[model samples]
Target: MNLKARITRTGAILLGKYVACDGFDEQQPIRVVTHVHADHMLGLRESLKKCEMVLMSEATRDLIDVLKSPLFLMAGNVKTLPYKEPFEYKNEKITFYPADHILGSTQVLVEDQEGERILYTSDFRLPNTPIIRSDILVIEATYGSPRCIRNFEQKAESVLVDLVDRGLCEGPVYLFGYHGKIQEVMEILWKNNIRVPFIVPEKVFHVCKVYEKHNKKLGRYWLARSEYAKELRSKKEPFVAFYHMAARRRFIKEKAYKIFVSGWQFQEPIRQVNEKGFVIAISDHSDFEGLIEYVRKSKPKLVLTDNYRIGHAKILAKEIEKRLGIRAIAVPPTKPKKK
Candidate 1:
């Protein structure tokens, strides 16, 4: 089969693949942002210049502006599309749905005239998360491994409660994660009636403010650089604070207890910290079961995945075809191999 025949036969395209274009080059990019996590967006700068147009959610655009500095050059080549709106680009009609991963993450769906559709489910979480909507039928799998199943939230919460009970009743509780994850932690605390004065990095706090503007109540916390420092210092009740890795040690003093959250914690320096303090697996990515359910619902003809989870995606595809009798196969990641 010719290249066009192959692409036409299977309605799918990997990250660095071409559809009605030459080989997918970072310089020849099309509108693509599979959630706002750093890993998913590593090469976006190079990719942006390649494509004729760029499309993503408004919130994502705002967050990217904050994340990227001297944002003038990087911010110019994009257009913000509303959620689920059908837009035409590269002669194809496409729609974007909420990925439920982060505040402004999205899953891209492209529909052609022949009724063939391809959905790229950026990293997403099926369970209830703060400030994001869960899509019943998503596409692709970023977390399709059996090891993905975990009870990090429940386990971490129990440990946190115990640690809080043992604390001096007024010491600060330092919790660490990315900006978006920190907001999620704060939301969980609020829902469980674990109210406390919390701290987050200034950048994360800015995003939280955006969430609050949209009326998603997170927590009654102050930015570390914000006013009311005296009030936070004088706090006598339980408190929660979020910081980046660089700021972890300084904020987490001998008196203050520390907690780390993320799937990454199941490994590395995080595991080291878990020995003493606490680590939670509250992730924004889907688990194995969630990934399968999403694939079955979407019913795409072919599958594509990132390198780390490519095998997991392929395994899930096999199970899906066996159970539902659907034709599905896993495709390579955008990059042939990691550098």
Candidate 2:
């Protein structure tokens, strides 16, 4: 397939015909933001100024309203589209499919007037992630390396529950991860029937509300500063407190047990960081095998491995070509831009 495929230095995938996904290009009249990740918001301001319309899933738009200022979405040209429902623009069709990444993440499909299809998969995971067929595939390689496999992925949730259960027996338990990740842990604990109340900062508490509003029901949680939470903190009753990944340093391990969430673990899912602390492997992204499986199942004639910002896109593309016999190449990161 000689389809137009390339990523701007700022990590935006450009179809060059109708739209730009995950990044901005002044040349395209349409801009599609796949998720709320900071990297994907590159050139957003410019796109909003230049494009006719900027689009995202409704959940993604709400996430921005919560995590970011809502002023961005109040723009006239910004719009939301339903999943599986296509919106026709000029001579193309665009649609968003739910992604198994964060709360509102999605993969985008663009089909031009010629009936040629292009898919840009923002970060996603497999076994559950939907596979969309297209002539050209643009995929994320956050775990694209051959070594980036999660053998304990299926058991990660169990391990997390066990660790937290054990930690509560001693004292307060502290957990750290990104915004969406923290919310995900809430679901895992709730589904397992762990009813222990969660105490998080005010921001995370708001994030949890958004999750609940979207029908992503999480368990009982309280704001860290609330009178109830403060009383609970003083009592011997053990509870979990969540923090953003950057707060790892602010954590005082001598006071309580800590479980750091990460997906980079290749050998052991649980790694001992200190006597009272450990790192557990749990990621929202598809592993190396999952990435290959996606391409194989989708059967795209050409694969564009996105390495513009992170992941071993070059290695992943090479692996795809060798293992699946599919033509794949990494999009070079050029003229990198800040979020």
Best by TM-score, which number?
2
Report lDDT (CA) for all predictions.
0.57, 0.86
Query: Which candidate's lDDT is highest?
Result: 2
Q: What is residue 156's positional error in candidate 1, in angstroms?
A: 6.2
- Superposed model 1: Cα runs more than 4 Å off: 1-29, 70-75, 127-140, 151-170, 234-238, 249-253, 264-276, 308-311, 321-328, 333-339
| Model 2 CA lDDT for position 99 | 90
Tens-digit lDDT track of model 1 for 127-241 = 5422212212224455565565654545656555555444426477777777677777677777767766777777877778777765678978787776674467665455677
lDDT (10s digit) by residue, model 2, range 140-195: 99999989988888898999999999999997889999989999988998888877
- Native-to-model Cα distance after best TM-score fit, residue 122 in candidate 1, in Å: 0.7
Worst 10 residues of 1 by lDDT: 1-10
Clash pairs detected, candidate 2: 9-334
Residue 325 in model 1: lDDT: 71
